[model samples]
Target chain A: MSSPDDKRRTIRDVAKAAGVSISTASNALNGIGRTNAETREKVKRVADELGFRPNALARGLLTKRSHAIGMLTNDTYGRLTLPMAAGVSEILVDHGVSLFLCATNNDPRLAKLHLDALLDRQVDGIIFTATRIDLEPPPELLKLGIPVIYAFAQGPADSVSFHPDDAQGARIAVQHLHTLGRSRILHITGEQNYLAARIRADAYRELAGPSGQVMFGEWSEEWGHSAIDTVYSQSGPKPDAIFCGSDEIARGVIDALRDRGVSIPDDVAVVGFDNWEVVSKQTRPPLTTIDMELKELGHRAGLAILGLSRREKLEPGIVRLPCSLVARGSA
Target chain B: MSSPDDKRRTIRDVAKAAGVSISTASNALNGIGRTNAETREKVKRVADELGFRPNALARGLLTKRSHAIGMLTNDTYGRLTLPMAAGVSEILVDHGVSLFLCATNNDPRLAKLHLDALLDRQVDGIIFTATRIDLEPPPELLKLGIPVIYAFAQGPADSVSFHPDDAQGARIAVQHLHTLGRSRILHITGEQNYLAARIRADAYRELAGPSGQVMFGEWSEEWGHSAIDTVYSQSGPKPDAIFCGSDEIARGVIDALRDRGVSIPDDVAVVGFDNWEVVSKQTRPPLTTIDMELKELGHRAGLAILGLSRREKLEPGIVRLPCSLVARGSA
Candidate 1:
């Protein structure tokens, strides 16, 4: 249904229709340069009548600001990137900024290629994001001479980055169980190699004191189901509460507890992390979990990058945004 | 670590280093206008040495091609968009094209705003995508004087659109079960209002014949679990296999069957649609599911849009890409 290219109106047409020179029309439309108030209003009215939209590319060439940014991410699955991107786009769209999302999928060569493409487009700024906070972006990003920020991803020590406060997320999960009068809290989590798992376990240990039990395994429901067996098999006081590292693990714990005829929040309260709706809400008794607030992290990252693009002075360091707990049926 | 902007190399620097005029250097580097082979080589060498990347905006003014495309999507959770985006990006990145993803969250005003932003940027093409294929894109998109394509989304009757062959996906799922010696197959699916669910049910009826049973319910694990009780409670001859409309429902069915002490594959084989890894792979005994091949659809859509941008003659119509079955432990 689109019209022919020749049918599309241009600024030249607006200028001719307004009985003004091209420069005068441009100035009036842009509200730049000295122009008579009557002439400026006349040109604007004519442009509006013609439904003329200014070309951002042409404006960018003159202003040296593209009003566009690029997001370099390694999160191909979009588990983290999606929410973060939603948050970033939410903020940037209001500012009339467009975002280019380039997924590298952890391939170094691909990352470099995407980075170069973004540079060729002359994006005002770039945000590097990934699945985990431990993963680092390409080192070349620092030397691009443009504003750069990290969201839910690691960067150089001095670079501006945003991350979820995993320690606090864990503390709250354990504290919630304690508040419910559950003392013997057990931490069922993922691999020790994961920084999140370690951070959460450390926080759980702090809250649960000497009676704390930490079971490290894969981030899976099967592991959660099996860990419950390992705990109940031991000749000791059974845990009154279980805080899982992920929603999947919590689902598994709930299923395993039901299989063993244990009542949820009655015999053992269950809590999870990442607040993944699909798994958390699907659980028999919906999971009480910690939300990483990835979107908020992205929002902050977007603002910081915009600030840097505007040459605003900002202290460079990692900023850990707070995580919030979503109370559900299980805890 | 980035150097000052004044230190950034430009075409002028390359021209000065190569001892040629700016236009000559540009022509040589772009391989556009006729330039002596030796001068072209010299300009290229100097440009490479100086790390002078050409500004796409400046080149776009002459070429009228931005080498950038925009993707307008309504898939907020990214359940469908992520894989599709990966496919689109996979094809575009190789073509040196950057993709701008704008999330509208189904708000008409937001969609219009993002659409305007894409148009203002002079993007070479636009792709409209959404979670469901039955939903229509904004009517204004059809009026834009540019090549537009739809991926995993619906557009005008004659527009170029790519969608998963739901009937084919369902047939394959059912055929796979039949091939496994499963007879009296039961089809448990989501809401009947969904075109996907209806199409899949029709396909199931075709393969399953008169004995085919269809259970319409919500697309959730709870539904799958409860549907099983409903089926067994009144059933005379239990089904040998169950074909679910989604992975979540299949997971619920598998869990409920396990609770009922029904031996999988031995008593009841189950097949699920939407090879969603989180649910299919995590289900007890895993799950054999049909993949929508959304990424492949994206790849084809990218290629089609690129072809249209190049003014290549392409037949405008809906193209239903095929689906494939992923074999796992459940079936």
Candidate 2:
């Protein structure tokens, strides 16, 4: 192994060794050039073998970018967004960008304070984990014209976002039961106004084929109980399967149903969304849910934001990542 | 409505209102014996009426503190710790302290860099969120000798920490089951070396009486299922109830049981821990688990670390907060 004690190699050394200009060597190393593939590969290999790691600051200076992605989150309670932020960070780290994370917890003046904290740090791009954009983003964020993407959910207004395919996710739930030859499916989901609920509701109607059983409320266990209770009210051939909008709702649906002497699968199979192990794996009946792949969302958001300026046109819009099923006993 | 044009009122304005020197007014506000209680109350009431809030920055300068706390999270991938950090932030926010937050993404090298960043910005105190103390804290962080409390689990060495009362938490589970007139309860848990698992095991052994079943393994749904299977293999009157180490394991156990068409509560009641809505509320049977209230842990850690110094010859070594049983249908 090359020792740190050995003559430390710089990008200049690599450029000299490869008989190329410093900028050309940097462009090759960073994959930002129109050089021939052979030349790029040869220079890269030599740079790696010589341990010629370019000075990030110098590269940033030349590129006129920080290569630092900002993650805006709630303060003090930054924990809720930490995992999601970590996912974004992991993706950016591999791309050689540092994560500039900021939180606004103490004061909920909405995004005003937190947004300021992030922008002041001059991050190249931003990823927000909140379900909605809470405050009117200072026009400065848009005027600065940085590439921003909302992960998990969309921010307010016309900000382009990357969201899980919710309707498709619900379709998978319906299909899983359909494949098992189960009809009479009941949909238990979060509040009506949420975009997730709207999309999933549309999917249930599409798959359940008219007379679809749709129940809506908050993403809480109590909502699950209440929704199930309402479903049980009309006792004419109750649903044989249930599609829960989230794992939380599914858990409540199962529990409330079980309490009513309804057996899961035998009487009604169940499926959930969001593969949070603490909820699904710990529940009495392991739920088959959709994996939103949050980490992947962060990774893509990082890459997308970092590469925002690559195309000099405003092509920002929704980038829907696919959702997949994680089958367990309940479904 | 209050005018947006109004400048935020401050202590100097309050002192001016009471026609007192800044020192005399500060003594009154802080009750440092330079002013009588009656004078203090009068001055406070006047300050309130004028909406004069203490200028925390200016005051912190006087106090040689920031009236702000820094949080350095060693790892963010572990979703369980998020609540702990959130709780701390929530509590600190209520107490009116700005929290400077950063995550290490579980990289010690990055953690050091963050420490340097926080130090460069001059944070008053730090709450290091971790399951263990950092073996090698940044040299400057150590040099700053600012108070730091390792919240969530025990510190790596003999540093201060705040964790849920796992021993008492386990006892609560056993006692809850016992109250249900079910004595044949099995204890399923995680790695014995983890501080929480060890304390929980001790509590189970001591408070569970002789017939209670006890077992340990990694905290996962797979382990929960295997543990239950092992207990049933013994055959002699299968356990009427099971106390799971975590919500994940409980979900697995319940899934396996449901797959076998076993009944819950009627045939076997199951209880789990960590009432994480992210996971627990989404499970089938909506697991009956312990609410560790991690948000409160973060809050306490914020205060403990900032209010009392680790190097100062004061304060407690460890603080074990209470955990509560969030009763749900699985049990």
Candidate 3:
């Protein structure tokens, strides 16, 4: 007599009926597994009677695929890695692959120590999100032979990756301003050595007609402030709109502009990259920036790794995902 | 003949020079550990000539401590956990402890699986970052009796904890608005079921003086937009300032206000929590916020757990950290 909604069954309800941990229930139902046959059968029997349809991951595991993804970021970039990893996790979770995440502190000494830990546990594939793609990955990391994809920053290795299409995102910004009848765009950026910054600066110039100016600096509010001061002192029709490389740089520009009583959008339209929510939310005018779909990158990485794990012909090389223009009041 | 800095010392560097991992070198350095004494002596002689300072972790493991902290995070709030765990790991690394970090999808079943994995490896202590506090931990888990520290959120079992002082943070927001000559202020929030939200809402009312207004609802941008709409329509005086419960709500309120041509600061000053860099950097006017200092929180939890492992009286109960204000253009 009860509605279907009233009879909804959970892993817990099934676990209690089968006398096991929720993990056991999960393992039994989705068995690329590490659980006993008896436990799996008992849990499966309960799940069947409850009219439960197991998640895709459980189903994938039975075929020896585990349908799971492994994610790794070193502890050094702790602040940025979590959200990036979270975005990756959500994408994989939706695609029915469980994500096994691990973090290390960028201690080169512990490189193999921590990564091998994830490999030993047998994640179908791996995603390495690095803060600084500063060095070549250890040769041993290559030994695992699982599909390992790098995100956010690319590494010195020949693994697959789906990075933020910084070049495309920058070109979009430059083109947006040109379409709006604005000229003399300025490029503000982080350190010159950064891989993404280099691509973005190149794009800004190629797209900013003939007279666009570019400034290079570190990723800091102070750098942004310094860039604004540099722009203010220049002797020319001040660049109509500043195409900031990162939101941090944009804030510096916006703050300096406000301090000098310069009206935003009206006086100097600003477009920033990296739709980083934490930094973006606090701005005076909600900023219009580029949305780098990191989760999608994670999904692509997961799929690539899964494909590689099956000894399938993995499409070799890079995957650069498209970045979206998020128009807010700033541009 | 070399200066002390250039001088070659011995102990483990020779082992490191042999191209094996540091832990392997560590095993070689301590003749009493698992390695063959010949390997240990060879490593020791190489270390002596190479003048390698034995890594504290390598040295420390010899005298009854693994110098490792095992962290388990519920996948539900992994966004928060990732940064917190990273913060803790960095702190532990600084203290010469390697972090054994694992993500448990907040399922008790998986938690037990990971817990057993960590325990068998004999981590010094554990730090748990979770969302919910009501679920009972496994009896075997409870019986393990390792020192556990809960961060950002609580657990049902008795343990040590450290969380931001949300009450004080809310009070600071209200007090800041009071000084800004704003009388009618509104509170936009997340669901009441969250302990953090409830504490913040209660704090808002207590701090907002008698003439202020409080609006409680879900913690989404949509809720902020709708709540602001409701306040603007039937409200007693329009809220002069909006004290959003989270960064997400603040972003929505700002968007809603701007679409209606309402200016920030000149209209409604805004404040948010979590100081997520994403929102702060992307928004036009950077959000003025209270930095939850997640990394610092992790540091404390790591230290607390380590202290507990030594059978030291880790004062059982919550440790509330002070939140610092990050001033930006929004307010």
For TM-score, the strongest prediction is: 1
Q: After superposition, how far is residue B76 of candidate 2 from its true place, in Å?
A: 4.2
Per-prediction TM-score, chain B alone:
0.97, 0.77, 0.81
RMSD of each: 1.6, 10.3, 10.9
Which segments of candidate 1 are over 4 A away from where they belong?
A: A1-7, A33-36, B1-7
Interface RMSD for candidates 1 onward, in order: 1.6, 10.2, 13.4
Q: Give the 10-residue window scoring lowest on summed lDDT in candidate 3 chain B.
A: B54-63
Candidate 2 total steric clashes: 21
**Candidate 3, residue B75: how far the Cα is off, in Å:** 7.8
The residue-by-residue lDDT of candidate 3 on B1-331, one tens digit each, is 2345542233335655766666667677655558766667777766666646533322332443546567777653345777677677556655556665555665666666666555543467777776544334444454454667777667444677788888888888888888888777788888777778888888888877786566678766667788878877884568789889887788778767876678888888998877876565545577887777877887788778777878788667878888877888778
lDDT of 1 by residue, A224-329 (tens): 9999888778896888999999999998899999999999989999999998998998998899999999888889999998999999978988888999999999
A139-251 in candidate 2: lDDT tens per residue?
A: 44554445676666555556667777788888888999999889888888887878778888998899999758787789887788888888788767778888888887887
lDDT agreement of model 3 with the native:
0.69
In candidate 2, residue B165 scores what lDDT? 83
Best by lDDT: 1
Better of 1 and 3 by lDDT: 1
Quantify all predictions' global Cα lDDT against the true fold.
0.90, 0.69, 0.69
DockQ of predictions, in order shown: 0.73, 0.12, 0.09
User: Candidate 3: deviation at residue A122, Å?
Assistant: 5.4
User: How big an interface RMSD has model 1?
Assistant: 1.6
